[model samples]
Target: MIWADFSDFVSHSRQHFEEGLIRAGYEEVDGGWSGQVEHIAGRTEIIISLPPRFPFVPPKATPANVADVPWSWHRERNGALCLVADDDHDGLWWREAPAFLEHIAAWFESCHGDWKDDRPDLDLDRYFHAANDDRLYIYGDLEAYRGEFVRFGTAPNNAMVMKGRGTRPAKVSKHLRDQFGYVADLGTVDVPPRNWKDLLAHIDASGYLERKIRERLIGLLVLIYQRGDHEGTTFLKVTPTSNGGIDVRRLRSGADTPAARSARSGKDSVELGTRGIAVIGVGAVGSFVADMLIRAGVGRLTLIDDDVVMPGNLIRHLVGPEAVGRPKAEAVKDQLGRQYRLRDDQVEAMSQNALTSDVVFQVIQNHDLVINATADFAVTAFLHAAAQAAGKHVLSAALQNHGDTIRIDVLPPLAGARPLPASASPENHQEPTYYEAGCGSPISPTPPHTVIETAAVTVRHAIGLLLDEPVHPSGEIRQLKHTRNQ
Candidate 1:
């Protein structure tokens, strides 16, 4: 009845395997039973290692010889026969020996396919490394074995663990030395990290070399879905550091998840991840900011503006001349879906007159963050008060003067040191604006580059605020000058 007892579960789970292997005259080895299984690909010897606690702990099975299977989850250095890690509900790992043998046999058969064949099924590696941070960078081609984790364990001499990477597991250490012809004596010799190479080159590089590839307590799976799905097996290495800090390096095996794509493409950032953002204007500045936020990976965006696009808007707005009649918000939303590949549901184009809309507060409440670039006095005053009442962070950016200087005001949540502007006119923030006599013309005719460049600066700060990283001078007006031909 003991979970770790292999004999109790043997007859119940794998009677045929035991009987057949015994009849074939298999031998006992490595604290378990061993036998050769013949498949279409070739003959592979299996080693089943049962621990003291059986069913509860599950058994560790490995192949006696090396195998190169295209099972999506590459393989470990010691070649762990990665069945289910803990088979509770028939998850990814080996639950019962008979079923596992059948599945693994299929895996072996899959290896026969050409390397160029594109698999339709999701890769097993996709189920691992859910964090998908580009934390590891290497010059070597570790494409097949990225995101592999190995618990090198604490050195016998007891070097401190670094960022949860170094664990000095004994069996894994010896395996690295025997297989890779490198020194990994954590008890006697200290381990060296990639950065330690410079120091070791001058003194000694053989101290902690090759230990990563031979880890026994291999971190085969960076992720194992608990409430979701199951996937496993990976090829990764872990070495020790002279300063006691461990560096975990993985390959570039990719996935379609946003996290994985961000890591692979080097666009991973706090504010760039999935988020609900509301932009209350899609003019030249708002349009440019919206574009940057989308490209930065803001998950869902709601563009709010009642004004229609004009021919002049084409020069500075995100859209072209053909979109002259469409509302700025709706046009930007369409562009996001059609050109930027964002789903229609991910973007919302609203034509609500923000200056007069009573639901502006409700709209602001629905999003995680609000951004105002309309630069209208009524709209700014309304949003400032409504956002504060709804307990949301809002950023307002506007052209303060004709001399290429723009100002952005950040309202950090719960930091009510200053009140919202009473009026958006020169009387409110004591800022200057240029407006010609009756016709609404630009103060100094802002250029496309100036507007876009200013929007980029505001967006950088807005991103930080969306992540709760309030921009410095939180409620104060921060004016930024554009870099243009003087």
Candidate 2:
């Protein structure tokens, strides 16, 4: 139901919206409004339509002759201009119709002027329809195959490709061939093809469109092309059209190589990607801390947890109900892998108990740092010993006082540094009022907010340790008190 204030705002703004459009030289059409904007080349026609959820959702403006639009970077395949980035929320463009129209006019002028003032963005994929169901995995160094063919394999939902030395297909194992088809690269193009016609023309001009190759291109074709400073891959699905022509659709693709993923991870990724971290728990705080580190571009992570996800843990845990029975470490690893397109080497899951695992000491030695989030004194002591032996740093976070307090302790790698004493339980710490059905232990009443906030703080210290930044005054105890109005 619409709120009274919202209804009133809409009711009052409807007349002003229409008047603003008229003032901007727009005439009421069948469904919306139509207007013309003068550009350097000539006049360009534009159509504006108010969405059903007006004011909240911005009005959409599409070019009359979308195909004739010079630039394809900032417009959708259907000709709707992308005036704002997905993260842009500063301006409430929908509230003022005239300002919105002016924004569109500015966009057209920028496009007509070759978008000189706009930042360079390799957005050629916006020109074609996206194939949501299918995904292409790009592996190896694509730049090495600048003007050569590579080997690729295709399956129903997934496709894999790797760079080749030259035009010859590299020696691929039969097992890989069975999993991913090992075929010669379809072709290579210097520039991204805007449409199937342009793709075909490029192939023909390069003399790569032989009769045999043309037949092979009827189903699936992989093209390596230059996208700005780097080379990128595009997977095209070809189907015979009713008019005896071929339709090429671009499939969704992701980089499966470390370099590609690192490039997308931002500037600090290079440094973070080389550092390895080991998280000794996959509980609520541990799970989010690991996830945040991965998102911050940490290249390698080892998740150690023997606990399985339970329904009762959903309130504060990262995994969902689907992972209720799965090992927390494995579940978190799977989720992070899929979300970040991480390879197996990038994330390792150890489902063994960290306290008794034979490899715990080795894990501590292998990683640059170790994190203890188990909130159990025994586990903390075990990790502290292992970290001390390996001369590695350890950061530990826990909620105390029935979830009303947050405590974080940082142990440096220095020889004489010692772990801080655990805080004493508050006098008012009462027994849990609720318990899971099967478990005898009472559930800790920590809210989700406290869990996440603790995790954020933990990750900040963890990153500082990884980067060799000083995070002195190492021990912190914060009480989260509720404020009430007098």
Candidate 3:
């Protein structure tokens, strides 16, 4: 039952070649179907070995073994072609092997044609989805703990600062400079681009350094990109030539600082390296809170809101009036998402009300933490219930007394605690003067400074929640006691 279709394709191909219908034939070899398809350019052999799962799991085809085919450039080292660029393709896109068999035949024809033309792909490394890298070995796993010194201060000779631990020095010897050969940054890459050329072009485009200083191009260019964990910064290596081409290779960050030179980032390293968090609301209070959370390094964040940026929101929100009328969630993610140094797909925007979203719980489940800065009681209540039901933690915050006070509540898993009220009823919000734009409810007159105050308190509580510290009480109430003399 498993091999019926693939067996049929092979059996038919054998009979077809026997009767001269096509230039391909199949024979059993080493327990798999082996065949050669003769194209106009040349003939190439293919071996179709189906995993026991067959149609459910697509079989792989490998060409007859060849030597030293440059696994860096060719995905297949011993002439095996990964049948699909992606192995786990959707069943809808790839249901069976009949079409795949046809694909392999065509791929062989194209490869043979390209081979004879002498114009082969220069950037073939990008084609391989799963990397088969074992060429370069890091001695001592040296990169795992290497002290990181970022270039800082424009004071000539631009000094580097060691982002050291609490007891560590703010400055250290240029360890990376002294140890690595000609290390040049290709700038920040959150993830590998689909094309390997995006990384290679940085080295190829000329002028990373002065020709005099860079006469000896680094034997290996250290490319910094985002990885999948805390302290997520990682690297790769590539060798560039005079012709502006580079051979790309995996150079995982396996080096670490020796005990004598440990300039490790602090425990508060935001611990935000790659934590998945969700923020509900992106209004004035929500916007400011989101901005600080990102700055403090909460990794992946899902921003949810259904409101557009009102001209009034600009006065207290992080975004300017120029962004008026855009979805507040998108605006917040766009403006402040970059500075937080999130992952490639880390900051996501959902322009929907959390109370009404069906998959709201699923979204909450995806994150390590969920924050409700929406200040909507219904929404806050809904998230708290959802968070508790899902065995997750949620922080809900709101402004009160027309921004004179802000309240923060943290609900531990299954706490069943209702966060404080967002505001008084529509009629009694207690605004001395209300701004009216025609017919809707009157808008409260709140200052940007007040919003900033709320944001500061919210961040402190949120940092504690994310870092598992008891810096702020679970239901902390912060009041602005000092006032200007009227």
For candidate 2, list the clashing residue pairs, or say none: 153-181
Candidate 3 to truth, TM: 0.44
Instruction: Please give the CA lDDT of all the candidate structures.
Output: 0.56, 0.71, 0.57
Per-residue lDDT tens digits of candidate 1, residues 1-486? 577675755545455545444665567776578866667878787777655544445555577755444323324334554444223335424444565566556645554553234322223332223323323311122233233332322222322122233334454533452111121211111111123332244223554333443342333223211111323222223345466643334333223334443443224455455688888888989998888887777888899988898775687789988789888888888887776567778898889888755668777878887888887878887887777677766888887554245667775434545643432323223233656564476445666777887788788777777666656545444344444453
lDDT of 3 by residue, 196-289 (tens): 3664464445644333123433333333332222222223344455676544454433333232112243356446655777888878888888
Candidate structures ordered by TM-score, highest first: 2, 3, 1
Report the Cα RMSD per candidate: 21.9, 7.1, 21.0
Candidate achieving the largest lDDT: 2
TM-score of 2: 0.66
Q: Ten consecutive residues with minimal summed lDDT in candidate 1?
A: 183-192
Please give the distance, in angstroms, between residue 134's alpha carbon in candidate 3 and its true position after superposition. 46
User: Top model by TM-score, which number?
Assistant: 2
In candidate 2, what are the lDDT values of residues 121-194, reduced to their tens digit?
A: 55556666765435565556555554444455554556655544323224644564422211223243333456
TM-score of each: 0.43, 0.66, 0.44
Model 2 scores what on Cα lDDT? Answer: 0.71
